[model samples]
Target: MFRRICLQLHWLIGISAGLVLAIMGLSGGMYSFSSELIQLIDPQITRVSPSNAAALSPAILLEKISQHSPYVSSLSLSDDPEQAARVGFMTPQADSGAKKFEQQYLNPYTAELLGKPASEDFFRVVLNLHRKLALDQGGKALTGAATLALLLLIISGMYLRWPTTKSLNWRSWLYLDWRLSGRDFLSRLHVVLATIAMLAYLVFALTSLSWSYEWYRKGLNALLGNDSATISKTANASRAASNQSPSKALDLAAVWTSFRTEVPHYQKLILLLPSGSASTVQILYLDKQAAHPYANNRMVFDAASGVLQTHERYADKSPSAKLMASLYALHSGSFFGSAGMLIMMLVALLMPVLAVTGWTMYLSRRR
Candidate 1:
């Protein structure tokens, strides 16, 4: 009876989510090695000369790019030291009045602008489509639904994999017969691979869902005591103080230098430039010597006065916050480096097989 219940749940979940899972799995598989693919497709963009004593300032780089296109939006620096620095700007469309945003590569050492890429650049388009679901409303919804379904599939899959029989045999648990018929062989392979891929699928699904669904994100935030109301109140208080009088301008470079000096052991530094009305610069540093990359330390600096706003070493984060942050790293397989990424790729590849095998099983049973 228990086995029968498990099979029914598994089949129902698989059938409902199969097509969406296949699409997400294939797209995710493509994105697994996107960094390498980007390098291979556009070697020039990835190339960077050694930084000289006269490295370009962020303000100067932004200023030069603003000359050609005045509608400057946001600028981001690549964390990868090997890659050329990038500045993005919003420019007025030539044919239409609408604004369009694009990224430009720069030589950090010389601050020289490189040639703009053609609109048809392969890797850029692929990553955009993969991330934003082809920039279509329907596509995004479909992907979101797929992510939710993936979560259900993982739950049902685990139930199915749980050992139900009293007698434990190697053949039943692990072995697949080479001499078996094609249908049987495929079924065994699908079940085994799905079992192995379950945890990865769950991590990817939850993270994607957190991005896609507001309720999930809010719920997660609430669980971590990071309620939206608290954030809003904090922002409002900060804004009120700023409105009272002009705040002192903060030196972003000095803030970064101070952070580095304070945390001398960190290997990588990521600074997120503030946008909209926000007045804080978030700095994240990765300690390579740490057991896990997700445990990297983080600090926030006041954009106006360069005063330390928040200092949250990964170890200091609330348990729930730490779990959520770790999920981000795990979903991308960066938590475990190259081996983890390769494992994730293999799991992604097996998803299609699982879907195909599931349908085959259904059809055979109906016959």
Candidate 2:
């Protein structure tokens, strides 16, 4: 009776959310390779010929950027010598739709503006399609619903696909028998691939819950015995909020130096200028092997006092924080680096293929 119920719910949810899952999966798969491909699209602008010379210091780079642009909002460093330094500039209007701040690459050695990279436009479209479905708030809600449905599908699908016996042939369950034809072939192949890809799908689905539901996020936090780890601003953010606003024009150079002393070995550093209520100079730093490269770790400091306000590190993260950080890694397959990315990309593509075959099998069964 329980198996019958699980099967019915699984089929119902899969049919309802299959199209959305496929669209999201395919787009996500493509985006797994976006950054590298984006740079390659316009190498002349995005990539500088590897310089034998050391790149400019953070202060020098920011100063050069400030002179050219209205303000230096932040900057991102690339380990690759060929990669141009990404600098942020404030626009007249807040970014209601696109890139957080208008970003352009600067030739790190020369401080020359490289304009926009080619992948900016392409990623914008793909990201919009992935996140908001090329629409607005309504689209976000729809996608969120689809994500919730996917979570349900994972839970129910696992129950329905449970092996009848522990001794069931592992080969038959794991691989397709090409000798079979028609409905039998589709059913067997679908089960095998679905079973093989379930773990990847499970990771994607679990991570996606945070974005799709606030309740789920809060619940996850509660369940994990920690505060929300999705976005931590302070060093002891797991304990209390300590984002101090030091009202004054920040000395970018000093902030950069302090960071150099604090975190000598870092992956990428982004320095955000104080604004509005946030009078602290927040520097976001990621370790070379941080699970989520960009968003996981941060160090906030008082701009006026030059006193450290908060230092959020991945290693210092609580269980909830670790799980939250793992979201990006799982999503992009960056957890395992190149191999993980390839596996995730392939899994993403397989989502739609499975959806189609599963749908066909259901139809055939009904017939």
Candidate 3:
């Protein structure tokens, strides 16, 4: 009786939430390769011809950028000379809703503006569709609920597909019987493909829940022994301290020098410039030889005096801290490596297939 109830709930959820999950999955699959896609699609704007001379200092680059545009938020510099330096800005929209993020590339060697990458806007739309269905706050809540439903669907589907002791075998669970036609083929395909993609979907649902639900995020941080409140308080205190004095022009070259002195070798680095009254410049960088793509080392430097205030190396972090820091990488499957991301993308692409098959079977049953 309980199993029957579980089966019914699974069907109901699959029909109700399946479409949303499919959309999310499709968007996610596309976004997983966003960086590569952007570079490929807009190489002229995104890439640069390498020069033998050193790239312009951050100060000089910022000065040149400021001449064309104001309110620069962050600057990303890559050790790969072929990559253009990206400068980011957050501008308020006319509707006064969410701020729009704009990014422009600069020739690191010459400090010449290299108009925005065309693919950036496309991916931004894809990301918004995945996260919020492009409907803003209402969409966020719907996606969160759909994610919860997906978690339930995965669990119940696994339970329903569990084999008895005598029937337990790799072939029984994993093999797809293609000889069957119509409903039989779909049923086999749905269960077998879902079983194959189960772990990846679980990772997607679990990691994505943090973005959708505040309670889930807080609970996760708690589980990981992260004190979010304390971190918030510390940040507030830093901002408050910075607010005490009027904002002044920053000597970015000295701060960049201080950063280089602290960490001599890096693959790529992003300098988060201070905003408003804040005078603390934050630098996040990956070492030349790092554990993974997301293994970021952070340093906080005083914008005024160019003195290094604090440095936090990814290697020095505790296991939980490391896990917390790696949530994005884990979600994207880049934490496992390139092969993991490929697997993740494949699984994500399978969501629409699963949904279509499941719906077809359901309609056939009703008929």
lDDT of all predictions? 0.67, 0.74, 0.86
Q: Mind sharing the TM-score for model 2?
A: 0.87
Candidate 2, residue 341: lDDT: 91
The lDDT of model 3 is 0.86
TM-score of each: 0.78, 0.87, 0.94
Ranking by TM-score: 3, 2, 1
Model 2 backbone overlap count? 2
For all predictions, the C-alpha RMSD in Å is 5.0, 3.9, 2.8
Best by lDDT: 3
Best by TM-score: 3
What would the per-residue lDDT of candidate 2 be over residues 1-367, giving only the tens digit for each residue? 9888888888888888898888888888878888888877888888887667888877677666766665556677766677788877655445563323467888888888889976778887888888878888887888888888877887787776667788767774687789999999998888788888888988887777777777887787788776654343333432221122123466666776777788877767666667545556776777777665635577777776556777877788776668666777767788778999999999888988988987998898899
Q: Which lDDT tens digits does candidate 3 get at residues 1-367?
A: 9999999999999999999999999999999989999999999999999988999989899888887766577789998879999987665567875556667888999989899877899999999999999999999999999999989999999999998576689987888887899999999999999999998888888888887877887798799898878655654654443223223658888998998888877899888777666878888899987777899887888888889988889999889778877878888989988888898998999999999999999999999
Residue pairs with backbone atoms closer than 3 Å in model 1 (clashes): none
Candidate structures ordered by lDDT, highest first: 3, 2, 1
Clashing pairs in 3: none
Cα deviation in Å at residue 135, candidate 3? 0.7
User: Which ranges in model 3 have alpha carbons more than 4 Å from their true place?
Assistant: 91-100, 231-247
Worst 10 residues of 2 by lDDT: 238-247
